[model samples]
Target: MAAPSAGDRGPRVTGAARGGTGRPALARCVAVDPTTFAAAYWGRAPLLSRAAQLGAPDGFTDLFSPADADELLSRRGLRTPFLRVAKEGRVLPETRYAGGGGAGAEITDQVLDERVLGLYADGATLVLQGLHRVWPALIDFARALGATLGQPLQVNAYLTPAGNQGFATHYDTHDVFVLQVDGGKHWRIHEPVLPDPLERQGWGGRAEEVSAVAQGPPALDVLLAPGDALYLPRGWLHSAQAQSESSLHLTVGIRALTRYALVEALLELAADDRRLRATLPFGLDVADADRIGPELTDTVAALRAWLAAATPAAVAARLRERAWAASRPAPIRPLAQAALIAALDRDTRLVVRAGLPWQLVPDGERVALRVFDRTVTFPGACAPALRALLTGAVSRVGDLPGLEDDRDRIVLARRLLREAVAVPADDLSGS
Candidate 1:
């Protein structure tokens, strides 16, 4: 679909039922059709929208107050990893950099000690465990975008201040939908100049480094305000910078399984076959080597032909699996007994991890507790007692139904409390 032009207004969107109030609360000013865009430029750059994007709720900040953000940053061992501008194509270790604060400062110097800027642990980075609690609005946005793209979606968020460039200009491995949540930022999108642009499988190196040699002048340059969004297909070289203030944005990265990935996965599935597992050129003799060449080529050709024929079906199945799999929640690891007790005493507010399915239903004696994503369902007879736990109320196991002498329920509930899936009742109010 063509991007909404500066003078043209895009489609209007109303808030979904879950958005509450039943009124048209959140709306988008521009909405480009993804199918048309994908057909024309699946791996190219395209600006999606620049209007009404800011109408999405900002309630995510309320979930994590400045104090909660600080506690999370400190407790999770989160660090800012610096990307060497020269090696922008390479992934850096997570611990290599430190937070630089709101005002710009040298990596070696620690001037402002505030938690406002630099590399902070985004909820995704630290707890991959409780994203739903950290950014509920982004989760909803992902579902909306997924419906638009006709595929599953994953959303990640990051915050940076003026002069803090997260990474150097480069291409993403996957297509991306960038939403400017708060403040404004600048983007530089360069046209694809390399032959077979966006086809980096045979580039013999990372796309970022390979494209650097063929870098062209940016085709589009724009400053995105709070409600603006941009879509850049895979292999499009781009860079972003916050405009003299702090910025927060969510990047919805779409994972596309290409032919290369399918073949790789097939190879993995074929690992038990001696022919598939054997290294090529199996003999040292010159005659044997010459004879093996044709056979080896034939084997590769067969594999390629098979993959080429099966790719569409395979990719569709994989996408469906990924969509369902993405909804499952990460298992919460148990904390030390002492720490768990302390956390409970402090009346911490627990939050469900993002994407996990849950429903409230009436059971026989009380209410049945069924956690859909996890496939764990228990009788409603435990409702009266489990309801409090589900509601993050501070109640002991003894207060639960059918658990007077059972210790397993107590242990399980304690584990949940430690994971912040359940917390004391008082802490629930603010969050």
Candidate 2:
């Protein structure tokens, strides 16, 4: 696929020469030329591109309409350091940040609450859950980026107005790709004095923030117009502010797995055993330390050997599986009682969750359903009956699978549907 030019128009996907499948077409639109991006920002400074984000759905504002923004604000899901205030910083109440460590105070839950503010950074917040639903095009973009980077990708949406400070001048652990969706913003990037810094996840770390020197007079003082993007490597200290009436952007964080995380996960797995779960010999007498030395060394050596033998494919597979398992689908309220029943009774389509694998097989008279590692078969005569339940046909639990018979099937279907593993579709007619 050819690189998108500045004057390119239409859906970002349209710019790419047509390919055989939608996947390939989407791939061309989203694939970041890593070699080009890496040369520009990897371990050096920030790189900005005007219209880099033109392909991004409607440049932020167009992507999230007023109503859509309202819905996101009302969602009480995962919270993070999502909001910014002009001078006050985060708008969430002080109580929300009182618990946990000092880090908890850094994020404001008000962003997740959808409370609107003027002058203050007020806009819809889109985390993984929100993105999973209303943003298929973005998801496709993310998937393509992941494929190009050979790593997992996470895209976060931030909307703010002029003078809003999304974050302080600090470094993140993962590399970031910031795409301006609407309006404009001023960005300042500085060189990192401390190279490849790591965060302390446990207690007992110096509370002082590491200071860094300015690289080259804010390096690039550029205004991000709609459809523009910037790439910054991890450990690159930077800050941003809306330069226009309002600014919206999607920051895609590229995750890099470290040996430390791998070891930590393996240790947690090993802790399930009583022997490994025992307290460490720290603070113990010198005599006890000597006795534990051999065991500790042996364990460490074994872990090292195991990790050394691990293949990149296996690690990627495990990461993908974990990501899919953790993903939560958007909540869809059931239709009204009468409408649901009628719709289900009629032939309808049913679909499995996105990014999940499933298989269907012909059963004696019905069909066998398998999803999210679970499987079940319905009798051929009950195909229509099963369809009703699968398609959200019934209003309440007693609708199709009636409270009396087929209780097991009803329970199983309910569980799958609730988890978003199964969805109803229109019959023959793709909806």
Each prediction's total of clashing residue pairs, residues at least 3 apart in sequence or on different chains, is 7, 13
The residue-level lDDT of candidate 2 at 68 comes to 54
TM-scores, all models, native as reference: 0.51, 0.56
Best by lDDT: 2
Regions of candidate 2 where Cα sits further than 4 Å from its true position: 1-47, 52-58, 65-160, 163-166, 193-210, 215-219, 254-259, 272-295, 301-321, 329-333, 336-349, 357-420, 424-431
Candidate 1 ranges with C-alpha deviation above 4 Å: 1-30, 33-44, 53-134, 147-152, 193-215, 268-289, 297-431
Candidate 1 lDDT trough over 10 residues, lowest sum: 1-10
On a 0 to 1 TM-score scale, where does candidate 1 land against the true structure?
0.51
lDDT (C-alpha) at residue 383 in model 2:
49
TM-score of 2: 0.56
Candidate 2 residue 286 C-alpha distance from true site, Å:
6.2
